[model samples]
Target: MEDKIKIHVLNTGYVEVDEALAFKDKSYNPIAYTGLFRSNKHKVKVPVFSYLIEHPKGNVLVDTGWSVASREDYKSHLPLKGYIASKPILPSGENIAEQLDKLGIDKLQFLILTHMHVDHVDGIRDVQDRAEFILVSRDELKAANKGGGRYIKELWKDTIFDRFDWNGEMGPYFKSYDVFRDGKINLIYLPGHTAGSTGVLIKNNGKFVLITGDAAYAHASWENLELPGIINDKVRTLRCLKWIQKLSKADNCVEILASHDPEVKPHIIEI
Candidate 1:
């Protein structure tokens, strides 16, 4: 039998932030930031996506959407304050549970988190009863526990650690992972935006789909190798972008997909 899989992009909401706010460092050319800021300014629609991967064995979710606590905290923070002040509602009325229901996925087999960012891992609590969570590594989980970034460690305080089965690193290249031997799905570590930030590569029906979670917020950012100011390591972020570009070009089977690209929204096929 031939291997098969289906991919879907779920839109969560939109956020507006100043372009300069995204790049706080001065290592790169200032003119570049100015140009990008001016060209892409209005609230950029950010889709909080939860990808459903249907394999022959079972179904898996790449990342969960936002949770009430994270969303409330984010709304109160300065970084996200402006967008919330404007009262811009999230795009979808359906939460992760409802969305999954619409997809007809009764039970999730696996839950893979790209990182511990609030928007990415917020919905984990919602699906805790249904699936086993797969995180970056034990060290990464430790770092998240340190609690300094936008992600709230307390929110995950009740997480059932025993439910976490995978505990190995992806590789030196950012922090790497190979999900399966047959190349059906591979988790690539593209750290920079966050300490243990990662991306996913899925092979479905001969085509390769690359789901980058905040590795590059927008497709143009990756094309230009532009680093976001909020990132923890600019050097590593650029390296990941370069690698993504090469993969999209040289690896004919691969198609790069950004988690928050507004332009790509129209192309998403809802299942």
Candidate 2:
């Protein structure tokens, strides 16, 4: 096995929404997350990120970002509810498939989806056949397949995905899956953002780095226990945020990243 794991953080595109969508405000407006019914001044744009993990066993891609079709016409690529809530801005050459091709990555051992949100899985069509296995947590798959809100089946209707349950004990909730059957890579359950939202944890020697996929929208989400505007369960969101905060303080944790933190730029993280 390789002595180190290299994580390439790629910014595939951007999503424009109300500021409240990224960080909830004091107002309990149910539709605050949707940019509609709000002033244009409240709009904020944040980058959409995906990770490429170079592991000794195999290469894993987490959450394919916006598709080129979105850049052309998001309305045609996304459902009415989705396009209304958030606007996707994918620049030329930023599509997930385009990035992979630029990196000379024609295939992947695993393609994992943290959750089935439109911005995260819309590009599945571009790389579905490139992966040997494409997976999502059983709970997430069940929730997404219901086909409502942001979980639209149109995003992955033609793609086949394997579902895996969280059977291993690890992380804050003791609910995780050891992806490579080794301690190096793990999928930690972090619900609330979705029924089965997941975070990726990569460990090497005594160091570790966590990819918090929308479980925590930004550093402040965990640091201040601030919740995002869209949430499935308030209690679960709080629990996940608190645990992430604690995990961030661990000596072994080299880094903890959020999926759409504007402050985070595309870079490489090694563990």
> Each model's TM-score, in the order given?
0.77, 0.97
Poorest lDDT segment (10 consecutive residues) of candidate 2? 25-34
User: Which residue pairs come into collision in candidate 2?
Assistant: none
- lDDT (Cα atoms) of all candidates against the true structure: 0.62, 0.89
Candidate 2 lDDT score at position 72: 94
Residue 67, candidate 1: C-alpha displacement in angstroms:
2.6
In terms of lDDT, the best-performing candidate is 2
Question: What stretches of model 1 exceed 4 Å from their correct place?
Answer: 21-45, 68-92, 161-175, 204-206, 266-271
Q: Assess candidate 1 and give its lDDT.
A: 0.62
Q: Give lDDT tens digits, candidate 1, residues 131-248.
A: 7545554545666778765666755767764323232354338445555555566777777788767788776655677888888776776677767757778788888888777666
Q: Which segments of candidate 2 are over 4 A away from where they belong? A: 26-28
